[model samples]
Target: MEHIKIGDEAPDFDLPGDGGTRVSLSAHRGKIVVLFFYPKDDTSGCTVEAIDFTALKPDFDAAGAVLVGLSPDGVKSHDKFKKKHALAVDLASDEDKTTLERYGVWVEKSMYGRKYMGVERTTLLIDRDGRIARIWNKVKVPGHAAEVLAAANDIG
Candidate 1:
């Protein structure tokens, strides 16, 4: 599938999220949505990113945006991570890789000179009208949540 671009309607999906609830893109239609995909839970980079997003929840809320983190991890893993970090934002489990494929973040990766398939840390800021406002692909965790918050603040 072609990657979503700015001005394109963000693809919608309803998937199981932390706390055993389903979260859908359309559910946040009237709000800016920050859809971020990460590789795993509790890993160094992923944990840092998640905590950063959690720390910026109020800023994002003030900017009228909701932060949603996606990963191939199951509900149990999400629960553990959220509980461990006391995360304020929603964490969605995409174990089936369905949503990941639709967004086109799942891809081939290389490490230790070996190739594998994994998620490319990416974030998409969807405007209140459902159009994608910006995309941060191959994300660098440092200061990323703040960057996203700034973008969301500028959308209006």
Candidate 2:
């Protein structure tokens, strides 16, 4: 798979989302799209990131941007995680890891000398034309939503 870069057209994907809906990147054309890929549902960093995005959903909407959180977990797991956190952002499930791999977020990671395949924390800001405007790799959750929002506002 080719690695995405700034100004490149973002890869389009349609996947199962929370509330039994499907989210397709192409459906959000003519608006900025925020795609945040996390390792797992209900995990520490991921939860904080989701909640932060949820809190800022109004601001993002005002900025004319769409937010989509994605993980390798299934739709049921996404539903549970969203409900458990009272999250407002859309959470998409990439059960087969195809989308994750396409975005180049799935990789071999190591913890305590144990290595395994997992989603790397990542966030992409796509412009109205579906081109990548910015990318945050190995993301640190703190204040990340605000940063992305700032970037979105800047681009707009």
List the candidates' TM-scores in order: 0.98, 0.98
Provide the RMSD of all predictions against the true structure, rounded to 1 decimal.
0.8, 0.7
Model 1 Cα RMSD, 1 decimal: 0.8
Q: At residue 91, what lDDT does model 1 achieve?
A: 91
Best by lDDT: 2
What's the distance in Å from true for residue 127, model 2?
A: 0.3
Pull out the clashing pairs in model 1.
none
Q: How well does candidate 1 match the true structure in TM-score terms? A: 0.98
Candidate 2 clash pair list: none
For model 2, how does the per-residue alpha-carbon lDDT over 1-156 read when each residue is reduced to its tens digit? 568899999999999898999999999999999999999998898999999999999999999999999999999999999989999998899999999999999999999999999999999999999999999999999989999999999988
